[model samples]
Target: MATLLHIDSSVFPGEASSTRSVADAFRATWEERHPQGTVIYRDLAAHPVPHITADAWSAGYAAAAERTPAQSAAFALRVELMEELERADAVLIGAPMYNFSIPSTLKAWLDNVLLLGRTAGETPSVEGTPTVVVASRGGSYTPGTPREGYEFVQNYLEAVLGGTMGLDVDFIVPELTMAGRNPALSALVPLYEASRERAFGEAVGRAKELAERFAA
Candidate 1:
């Protein structure tokens, strides 16, 4: 059976977080289709991974026989994260926008897993793996929007996950997430609701589509 690596980096739990909610729909649909398949889940908000350190950074460049004890210990966790990424046939990420960027916890996980000679570089191990990112944001940032130039979440991730790691990446954006909470954006609630509905549909559809592409 195929393995799905699902990561939720939103601070809010369950339905409170737009990204998490959309990702949950995707995972539920995937599980329903692949009853016997495996899922490796990580809740980065609840249990944040250690940020990259000097020891961890240095160890990746050192040969097996040259690494010190500290480097070995630091590199162990990085190896574990990378192994999970490598073993997965498909990946699902809940990358909610925060300050026009990704959560720091998600960044930490990316730092640990992005080894130069391993997950990164030409002909990477998981180069062709399918990845779906749920990019939920507080406001609309479409191409024609006033603040479209401020969009960094999708652009940054496209470079890292698609360009650097070589994964085949797709995004399901649920925009205007703050419409219900922000008084100033009350008029845009209708658009936000529509976007949310669209995101859920995309998530479920993408899961089923990917399920058909691989054998158990």
Candidate 2:
């Protein structure tokens, strides 16, 4: 059976989070299609992974047998994270924009898994792995927008997750998510609702397509 690694890095919960809902849509459809498959979930906001330390960095490159006690403990999480990624057939990430970038918790998790020989350095261990990222932004950053180049969540993830790590990434973005809620963005409420609907629709379609494509 195929395995999926579902990760949520949103600080907000429920209706307050667009990314979470989009990812949830994907998970729901995927689970229904593959009832026997396994889905491993990690809520980064609930249980954040620690940032990689100097000792952990050193230990990552060192031989397993050469690691000191401190290094061993520090690098243990990396081992677990790596194993999870390596074992998964697909990876789904719900990463909401935080100040135009991915949440620090997701970044910390990347640091733990994107190692020299484990994830990317030596020919990308998870190359061609289908990874979907539901990236939601409170403000618009599409073409012709004043802050076009300012969008970094999808760009950065595509570069690192696809360009560097060699994962086959597909992004579903819902922009202007705070339109109706945030007073400053109230004028864009109509656009926000439309984008939300389109995003969720695409999320379900893409998830089902992927699940069926990889189902055994």
Q: Which structure among the candidates has the greatest TM-score?
A: 1
TM-score of 1: 0.99
Please write out the lDDT profile of model 1 over residues 64-111, one tens digit for every residue.
899999999999999999999999999999999999999999999999
For model 2, what is the C-alpha lDDT against the true structure? 0.92
For 39-125, candidate 2 gives per-residue lDDT tens digits of: 999999999999889988899889989999999999998989989998999999998999989999999999999987779964989
Clashes counted in candidate 2 amount to 0
Off by over 4 Å in 2: none
What is the lDDT of every predicted structure here? Answer: 0.95, 0.92
**Clash pairs, model 2 backbone:** none
Count of backbone clashes, every candidate in sequence: 0, 0
